[model samples]
Target: MSPGKTASLQLPSFLHGTYRSVQQKVKREGLRCAEQYRKEGAFPSPRQLLEVPLGEVVVVQGVVDIQHERPVWRLYMVSEVLRDVWEALDWEDSSSVRDAYEASFLETAWGALFFTLARMGAVSAERTARRLEAVLRFWDPLECARYLFKKPGAAQTLEELMVDSCGWAMDAWSPELEGPVRARLESAAKRMERATREDCLEAILRQMPRALAAGHDLKHRQVLADPAFQRERLTMLDTPSFERVSGACTSELLEKLYDWDHELGLQ
Candidate 1:
């Protein structure tokens, strides 16, 4: 009985299987580039995710031929490639502006496109002013007035700051959109919903790691019995098949699995 060496466990790898087969072939090349923008009936904008190669086209021979597509149907191709790289995607574009000499252009992709346009809003008001004039074409009006007055309470104020300042002034246009912009004078802004909801729930628990991988048998408990994931047992195993649970499971254990299931009540 001397053969018991069970201690070499190097097994845990699926952190979204290398972008989950490139996020399911970039979501089938963003639904066939959104059905060729609904057969030219329009509505697929952001310059059709940067024109050509509809979906799964990552042709980088020159430098960057990127297009992973789809954040709500390729949000105008991620708002025109972040408005053609908003001053080099400025989240205060680093190098600490040559250590405060003051001309760097702030990037972390404009602090992740200003925390995704301060959590965008407008269910109405003429369809959120035509989706904030198609998301301010791409942003620049004095960096959209320092991302709506340097982040007070980090978003959800004054029509989500006029639909993220008219979708960052329809893409880009700056003569510093001048006038009475005093309210948000940068007291070290940034915190838009706890850093964009923990960076979109850590990119969905690093692309789903099998509901916390121990024994692994939960192949989506019959779609969690389906009362829309029962009022929150920590967001009732957040679907796409029990998205690898354990994100520290509590919201009072998702309100006690909403009284033990009416199909896990997502009330």
Candidate 2:
């Protein structure tokens, strides 16, 4: 079959220069370029590529054009991204997801270091990045776990793997899992100092009482013990006068707090 036609995107005024030629060249060598890009770790998801308008003008050089040796090439690239996302949804393996999260952390850390050192005039961005890269060369996940958690859990959570990568670690909690979730994650960070991928996985399934206890202890102090931390302030002092409840409201609130007796442990 003949190769697919070169698809051109309309460019915005800002992207008027050389974009057409670039797209054509990119299209002409689409498969080769894709392979090279993957080898160099430029994994643009197929969904992301398709989001680009084929003939749209560039507001910021924004357009999506794809030329494939065969339609299957486009299909294949999309399949990979779908596969990873699907696995995450299924809560399976979860390693690739962890890896992506870890990589993001590294990017944040590298960026932060780059700016900090650059501002201090201590090192060039290039040199600072190089040094960070070098440091990561000898970085081992297990060693990190052991160091961080003196009483490390046998298993680390998905976020624990990204402890060194602060950005990824920061994102480990979802809006749904924000409270006790953080304490569990901190526990994972502690584990990362010593545990391996295998060790970490095993520990979770075992549900080590020690691990849970440690996580709960941390969470109590960090998230729950102080009512101040749990209570949401609805109004400001300057806005309105609020009624102070001495009896009924206080009693009701206390009952609600301990209502789920046994389930409190699970929470």
Candidate 3:
């Protein structure tokens, strides 16, 4: 019910005009405006929306002015976002959580993407975002994971939390799972190639692998590379955060693309 009407965020003096236009777009399209604005390569202001693989599309849209719709509308919209996120996951069909993990390389990455999409509009959690102030403060996306979820042991990293929640991080990967696993990986590569920036990062990182198992299926479809090769970094899926090997990212998750011990395959 008039969702965009609630988005009266404070605009800097220069962005007043752009914000007005964005408002109109949001009004017409609701959350669907996220995709349109993404294509325009701007958010509340002019910013590259599709450049980063892990950090794409202005993440949370700096939601100021916590104006939510009526109770029923808010509830329904929340549920819709849940359903959309699940389909967005598009996890290869699996009989067990362990099978699901093997089918999709980023079992934990799926968790990260899932939480971000779910909290995209949660005002209370946004209020509690851990302030990273040395001199100036900013939102620490990683730290906020547990705080936002209001669970003490949700995780040090969202991926870990997701692994536990989905029970998908099991070390039960096997040879029989190869077909579906490669299918999901190729699917991820295809999405990165298209790079429509619809759901942006949430759409790509779930199936994204830490390493390439076999490029047999991927030799042709990576549309973003010079030879139209399969690579995530050259595309919008490339984010600086994904490159770093901190406590946030698992060691195996950063192995060579062709490295098979990657959690989804060998682990």
Q: Among these predicted structures, which one has the highest lDDT?
A: 2
Error of 3 at 48 (Å): 12
Q: What are the per-residue Cα lDDT tens digits for candidate 1 across 49-110?
A: 12211122111111121223312122112222222233332434423322221111122222
Weakest 10 consecutive residues of candidate 3 by summed lDDT? 127-136
User: Model 3 over residues 18-70: C-alpha lDDT tens digits?
Assistant: 33343443243323323433355222222212111222111122232133221
Query: In what order do the candidates fall by TM-score, top score first?
Result: 3, 2, 1
Candidate 2 lDDT at 81 equals: 33
Query: Comparing 1 and 3 by TM-score, which wins?
Result: 3
lDDT of 2 by residue, 1-267 (tens): 013633222111211124344343334333432443346544332221222133222111011222222111121122223234434346554445434423332343222222221221122222223323422432322122111111222333313323433322222212123554334444433443344433423332232222223333232333333334323221221211111111112222232233322334577
Deviating ranges (above 4 Å) for candidate 2: 1-41, 44-179, 196-205, 208-267
lDDT of 2 at 17: 27
Ten-residue region with minimum lDDT total, candidate 1: 7-16
Ranking by lDDT: 2, 1, 3
